[model samples]
Target chain A: MEFQGFRRKDGSVGTRNTIGILSTVVCANEVADDISRHVEGATAFMHQQGCCQTPVDIARVNETLIGLGKNPNLAAVLLVSLGCESTAVGEVAKAISEAGKRVETIVIQEVGGAAKSIAEGTLLVQDMVQEASRLERTSCPVRDLVLGLKCGSSDTTSGLAPNPALGIASDLLIEAGGTSILGEVTEFIGAEHLLALHARDEDVGKQILDLVKRMENRAKSAGQDIRGGQPTGGNIKGGLTTIEEKSLGAIAKAGTAPIQAVYEYGIAPQVKGLVVMDSPGREPEILTGLAAAGCTVIAFTTGRGAPQGFPFVPVIKITGNKVTWDKLRDHMDMDVSSVMEGEETLPDAGKRIFREILQVASGMLTKAEISGYTKAMDIYTVGPVI
Target chain B: MKNDAIMIHEKDNVATALRDIKPNEKVVVGTGDKSSVIQVQQPIPYGHKFAVRDIPGGEDILKYGEVMGRATQDIAGGTHAHIHNIESLRGRGDLER
Candidate 1:
């Protein structure tokens, strides 16, 4: 299957040709936002973590910035720096430029002030957007598509209907030679063993288990019972009583495909099929990791309704509860409640969802995209602030 | 339609209610050969569970064909199974405590 996509100079295919105004630190966000507001087709990557951290944490921050700049969705990148952060801006710029994209930079201190930096950044962004706009979509194979899977606000219907239906959709994508990423390592706690059985090799299986154990150790270090934090209050209200229960349901989203590889947070998958990304359970942070990993679109399953989207990627929401569908129809993209009604078989529902993914990849805007659901997203870190 | 609540598996003594069931609503259990009707003891929310058979304290409560938690108190047939009556013991507790 082939769809129209923008071809990047770096030999990557982009579903969208966007110019990004990336802020190096939270202090530089206002300037970046101002610059983006002045340029059509420009979006800002604003976050809270570009400074004040340990060396390892700082390097992670640098890697994430470089990853976002290298994302195939971006046609060009403009780095807006505050001139005094700990982030290695030079290294990030070098990496993006080496990836074959036009990279521009501006420092607030060097440019005299926020107003001056915004002016310089806006001019750079406008020129980039004009170039980005000139790029035409060309035929790209389905294998070029990378899909990110996420779920939040889970309910009883999630385990029984929605997540499993998503699994079917995932299987279809993998069969078509497309890549699907199952993230949120924290949610894979009790279900890691089940997923490990599908790994490509024994070593990969061990790595999958290792990621799960690492997450458990993090929770244990915090000295809180993981169950107390497992099914949030919302899950309990929606009939989920424990993390084990949630994990069983969550694993259903991975489908039956063999696990191809395991990747660190915000790192692109090395092999084609279904891959796991080591990430936190928080939706915003995990979504940030996914976007940095170069995912062009996100398929999110929810039973209790979540109206959140990252800055650049389109989030397609699916639900299996007729109640949530009716209540959040504006925010939701597809309804698999028919699964519960037995009106649609699992494969039939998966086909419908796969069709929707194709349409979104070809530029059919999602409800989140249309309603401006671009708020909850930030880089995750393991160190203290300042 | 009366047996909308399903056991999920043979080990489960509680069944998940498919719809909002009001107190005193008529409900039937099991297949045609041995099915029986009983009145709902209280209003059960959609997706919540109700006892299909008698359950004693410390016994595991099953849902989605797996153990969800343990019963904190005895529950008679048709009684709602929830936090008030069940204890969730699935993950590690805070070390600080």
Candidate 2:
């Protein structure tokens, strides 16, 4: 139940000690990326947000950036600002600094221009990375872990094998005192009532129902039926028939744990069991959303191979389809197709997945991370870029 | 049990084909008398579902013991059940409820 991890000064255990270069506005992403390109052990969280239209969206962008900076994975943070963006760079940096992580800020206009900001930002992140490098892995209990769950490009085998296996792993993690976050409220549409039955209380059950309804209504309000788009073409080709069937299969990834809490997109979890967050079912946005919510490790189940990974976290790609496992062997981290082939039991595959999670948390790099396929990611923003 | 097809729940009307099942193939659902053979009506591709019993058009397709969708065409028992034969009933814009 213990893994080697960097213990942050804030008393949180981190699976990775990274220096994050975050943009205060979309205009500053290039500088943030430039800084990360030059600094070792540093990465940029470049998103097309920060100079947005609506007040709610601007506030959401700022809060998500703050949470990402406060995540245990980041040993330090460097804020890259366009100087006049809506996001309050000073306030965000102050909050992160209060949490005991090394925080610094560089403004483009204030520092002269984009070129000047990049120069200053690179030097700052270099110093931060070196400081982060000084931290060493120590004894960290599994209870301190926040494991995020996601399933993408699904097929029938996903529900039959890897998903149930992941569910078992989710339950195992929860029993060991760790937290597991299940997001993608959009996937729970047809199976919302069923999933709600697993909530810890009536209130939580209602919240689960509300989130799914809200997600569906939001699509309807946009003048589009979720059915027209969901159970996507690929899903149908892969044998999925309805949103309910997909949702039924999708919920299996959370295992059999009771829903402990429900949260909005980009918000951190407060309770420690199985928490579900409101997020769309896309990889880049939802993956970034989960990372911002403070999950240090992510387990992604795919029946069709999904290769995207998070820049700041290790993503364990598990597949239950023998065809996909063979075609995308280099991308997948674990192949649990034996469960479907009747050669292995679900619990056995679940135990293997659990062991893989622990090993990855203890410094093992996944195929996606090793192949450097983790850089294209951004925060989830639903509003216009005006 | 090592299964060739699994009924996720007892009330489900469809069972997922664990592998590619040939036409007229017998798929075992449970143990001995508690089990029954569902003869395959067509080549059910791996990971797809088959009608455990005949389903009428316009009827709800049940899976995992819940209404997954509505059948678009009358489906014979053991025939492939997919998007070609089902339409989603949830998340419809014109749905009043």
True contacts kept of each: 0.46, 0.71
lDDT of 1 by residue, A1-386 (tens): 88788888877777778887888888888998888778778888888888888887888888888988988889999999999999889999999899898999999999999888888888888899887898898888888888999998888788777788889988988898989998888777767778899999999999999998888777777667665467788888987766766777888888999998899888988778899998887787888888888888889999899888777788899999899999997899999988776578888888898888888888888898787677546788888887
**Minimal lDDT window, size 10, model 2 chain A:** A219-228
Q: lDDT tens digits, residues A1-386, model 2?
A: 79988898777888988888888888988888888888779878887778856887888888888988998989999999988899988889998887798899998998999788888888888888887887889989999999999998899888778999999998999999999999988899888888888999999999999998888887666554565478777777778888888988899888888998899997889889999998999888898889888999999999889998887888999999989999997789999998777788899999999999999998999998787787677677767766
In model 2, the Cα lDDT at residue A188 comes to 94
TM for every model, in the order presented, reads 0.93, 0.95
Error of 2 at A233 (Å): 2.0
Please, what are the lDDT tens digits per residue for candidate 2 over residues B36-55? 67898899888899989999
Going through the candidates in order, their DockQ values are 0.46, 0.58
> Which segments of model 2 are wrong by more than 4 Å?
B1-4, B22-35, B94-97
Per-residue lDDT of B1-97 in model 1, one digit per residue for the tens?
Answer: 5355555666677776777888888875543235557667888888777887789989988765666678889988888887778775534646445
